[model samples]
Target: MSAEVSGVRIGVEERRARLRARQLAAVDDVAEVVEGLVALHATDPATVFLSVAARLCRPSGAIAAVEEALYGSGSGPGSGPALVRMMAMRRTMFVVSRESAPDVFAAAGRDIAARERTKLLEHLARGGGWDAAWLAEVEAEVEAALDRHGESGGARLSALVPRLREQVVVGRGKPYETTQNVASRVIRVMAAEYRIERRRPAGSWTSGQFRWARAEPLPERPVGPAREAVVRAWLRAYGPGTEADLKWWTGWTLTEVRKALKAVGAETVRLDDGAGHILPGHILPGDTEPAEPPPPGPVLLPGLDPTPMGWQDRDWFLPRSHRAELFDGTGNVGPTVWWGGEVIGGWAQRADGSVVWRQLTDRGAEAAGAVDRAAAELVGLLGGVRITPRFRTPLERELSA
Candidate 1:
């Protein structure tokens, strides 16, 4: 065991203050919020909007700004599609800042894309006597169709290229066996390869049906440098985390994680859980200002908010007792309630379009009142437009019922 460093402790309160200061909480700008956290979980379409809404001090302006950042064009210099939705880290979809997209693609997405492509090819081969030439021809046809028609939905593209309509068996003979449409797989491959992008939804913001557009070529970056850059950014925002946390978050091999940390010159520190790493100069002094911690108040974070999903080791902010209730079977989190930077419970909107919550811990009456007020504010923000989590947890399901 490494010797513990006295007076270098980062308690829960200190972490909470960092959350507010770093724009994880009480933030106002959508781009800045996304940039600060590096990315927002976007597996659920609603998660992107709700995540941004929860952080904005003024929730009224959040929707328009977030929409612009996500879908708007360059009206002026340095302002074109401020953020992009991409498949990265852990093979999950994330809304990443445009400035960070290239690095993310190079660092994490490229490998996953390769694996997906290989897997798809194998499945295709199993279905018939498909070869690499067939895949190339299909890809060319799909690209040509998109080029001629501009942005299109998967169904439209499938109509244009009849081959895309073919089905492939996945997990055959297994309990969870299912068939997958070749159109969806091709589209996924195109997106992962950075050859295409998902534009605005075909329906409302809550809809998952996205139109596809040709992607602008990403600026070239070497994999090593890109991995180091992303790792450094993550450490700065959610650091003092264990190697396991870094590996889990990035989906990188242990060797890759170690190399990236060494490349970034991360310093080792003793976390309550175990040894963790942080960027140099990130340590706070023993007698820093703001003697008392700031009141984090109550925040209703969306499902898969980066703050909660940021680390594999979540004991610092998430209580162990509430894990099963807050997270789904696949380990995806639901909409959560935060008080002073710690997740105290979970919340949900009833069918009547009212937001309700269940506090798992004995938070004081003052905290409870604040949480209630926050929930009411969130309900007002929605204006009776009830939102649902893509992956619902037990507590959220119970409360919503």
Candidate 2:
């Protein structure tokens, strides 16, 4: 059917091209790359660096550049760090541009903080018989400890506030039931509330353990306007997406999703799944006027990379047949191998510090060679530093073994 009748059909090729172009595949500037993606998934600390490396035109010095952009160099914006890592959207951590942090905080972080606080309180009451007043006192104590120490680790703060050392039973009667301290949960809530911020790690970029500091005041904007701004930015980066996609990505209600879209005046377009919304004035190119596709150089994206997790409907870029192999039971994606914007397979590092991949589809000898070259480059990048994913998929498990 014609695009006019079908509503601007965005075919696979166009989608692939857009992925390469918009994702900054050939760009080397770390700050700009992170800004373009809006947020780089920071759940796995290494994912931020690995994701930047994958998109750079040249991977050399990529890690240093990412660190500089993340921690800053006592300058501002271009010369210094313009991004800040914060927990937002589905309670996942992301490295968002400093300029965008306020909006993201208002749009999703505040609500998540509220839910998390309520949940933590319930857990405390049920698991430890702690009441709201006790929780409040503990939070105040923890905040005070952070203030006194000025950028301390969770363990340190827990040490300062003895109540933080108290344990609570989680998943009682379940096989995975375990006792956990209340320290991390309280700190996480404070971070989401913008009462504190997570600074650099105690060790390398791959370290998950972070030091916490009192957060600087962000420019205050109303939640409504902030939500609208966040939605607009999301559409610019991952548009032509369904309302469901926005809701899932932002952790907002259906009503909120509709409201944000309306506020942004998002335009609708046809997708293989259903009607999708794009930013106003965005027109998908037709087959007759197709854009040139990016060179089919293979790329190894770290697990939970934003490109793989950007949308709710991923069939346009990731094939259905490969889903089970590439993603874990929790729907978390592992390290993915991409060629021409489609997920062809997954990659993992071996015991010998070499990267190995299993191609689920045969994309000809040329593509295979390119993938091999990419794997070699990744191995060199690692320099014998064995990296393990926090969430391991079956394929990754098999390959690493």
Candidate 3:
């Protein structure tokens, strides 16, 4: 029995790649990495796109480095763009351009807004209110915006009528959706366009009051070769996980996930469930090694960060008891702070972009200090050139007060 247990532990370690392969093969090439991301139909390509795009600050010149890669820049530099498009920068919670949010939205123009709002509201209404005339109005506004902005992704919005109509409703003035609903539908539409296989909608999506809610959905089919390539790439970026973990991260079913695994069967190995929570002998890469755990300092991952929320078996990384605090009733995981490999607390960013974190543990100041530095670093990297760090500490009396 001891020998059998020892062998399984060894196999588990090998699957996690701690045992061999000095230069993790999966992480070797950036180009291949981008291709893999594109293939997975990563839930929010914008997030991954912005993340790698920011690799611009890395020793490799950002544009020069990304230009040669498969995902490349999804939105090339342009004059002005819309909030939805500009919000893409928010995926990283940082924008690389000097343009203010208003400027970006202004560039998006009222027409683009009309269309996005139209499409968004339609989904909120759930196939009501949005009509041919409403859509036509939005289309006209979109064309005018294109003429003003001189051609951008927003311009392509004019051509996505079929998809737009499928997801939204054209109704009377102010279509029946709320701000949250609009935000949700925009993400959903983008995911669909990215061809991501899974997107689960928030519970509010069913509430008539909510025109839309951002939740992941399970794609009709696991993404094909190109998309599969991206899924494999995600494993490299965020792996040492089980097949169930991948399914949880992307909202695909076990059956579809298994098929996708078969697609990449040659590159992975199975890990025995030494943890006992997940199935034993789960597939992980034999040559994969855990990335050195991220520095012990605190880092503020954006509200919709893919890291903590990436795997289904979140308890493996997070304490099961505190899960409810971060995950809402609708299953949305908000902005969270990480200290070492475990989550320490929740955070919210105010209008000035100052970050306020509520620690669930005593690591508050220690973690906040690190997150403060990281936020400043990211903000500066995004074109602020210089960003000041400010941490909000909740007073003990205030808790009782």
Candidate 4:
């Protein structure tokens, strides 16, 4: 319907325009796409590459463009258009522009690291004779091992630092209790702190099994300004979103969300569900005709694509009935077909490397034809490389099958 600014309703068409204007199109480059959207959701390895492929004017070599920007900097740490895969908001993995990486770390990664560190220490204590000092010592040993080889997997690092191989019990009294080696967990903590990074995996880009390498820590900045910058970017890219949406996306508390919004001088707007915020001075079209929005999209976006996952409240852009079919129980989205600003269907690649799709709702024949062209083009672009969503959903399963 319409969004409210001082009780003035901003229409959905206007909302769609705001987002598309900030997003990259075929004319844009890899860095622009990654930075424009704040970051590309990278929980699924193929998601990052496929997202880029969808936005480029020429899908050919777009995958390489993403790789060059992300791993191109070097096995070592540096920043520019270069991208870094790091854990951010909601503890989900994302590939963000290197320039904004530091602020993202300050705003979200640092908090995640601190919380994870605390939990890890508590787990260590229960294991007996292990504490922060022990963790530090082992972390150093792991780093030293990485330096020796330049890149190493958890298995190698664990062997090098025997302490890493030591077991710790978690969920001690719970039904799902299990034991884990300290190796991978420690590496994750270091990554959260920016002490090291995951380099490209030894296998195809689709593989999540990645290796680790020592990385220069992210440049430090005060949390206040950093959070402000991050919030500003979020509002600019995904604006007119409610506090709950930002809170759910960023995993920040209401206080932190409010403070950041104030620092950015964000303006409150009325959304269908409740109040939302937009960057100051962002003028929504008056009740008159909304500025001609971008043409309807038939782009095929991978599962966990950032757009759908950008907000907790999905009603404005997502069909209510299709939610269960497209999304997993925990909210990760599967490969979705977007016909303009809304999700119209879901697609999956068959085992034979052909793409198959099922419309959750008919979008008319013309839209269906466009969807077909997009799917066929993706088949050729993939060149027979198949993808399986890291998080599978009912519709994707049915379509692929």
* Model 2 TM-score on a 0 to 1 scale: 0.88
lDDT at 122 for candidate 1? 86
What tens-digit string does per-residue lDDT give for candidate 3 at 1-401?
Answer: 01111122323334323211211222334343333232212223233333343222252243234323422233565422111222221122212222222332222222243555556555555545555565455444544543454323421343532333344333435656433223235433433232111211222111112112121222233225533553454455555556666666544566756666667652443444445443432323453434343235555553344455555665544566776667656454655566655577766544454445667766656667776676555544334221111222222112212
lDDT of all predictions:
0.80, 0.80, 0.40, 0.79
RMSD of each: 3.6, 4.1, 12.0, 3.9
Q: Which stretches of candidate 3 lie over 4 Å from their true place?
A: 1-224, 266-278, 281-285, 288-290, 351-353, 362-368, 372-401
Candidate 4 lDDT over residue span 252-371, tens digit each: 998898788777767655455322433222222332234454677687889998888888877767767889999999888999887767778899998999998888777799999999
Clash counts for all predictions: 0, 0, 34, 3
lDDT of 4 at 282: 24
Off by over 4 Å in 4: 1-8, 73-81, 170-178, 272-293
> What stretches of model 2 exceed 4 Å from their correct place?
1-7, 74-81, 169-179, 273-293
lDDT of 1 by residue, 1-401 (tens): 12234445555556656655564556668976887788899999888888898878788778778888898864677656778888999999999988899999999999999998998788788764577788888888888888999878888889999998877777778898787777887788889998889888798888899988788788988999999989888876776567788889999998998888777766655455422433212222222333243565888898888888987877767778889999999999998998876788899999999999988876799999999998988888888777889999999899999
* Predicted structure 2: lDDT: 0.80
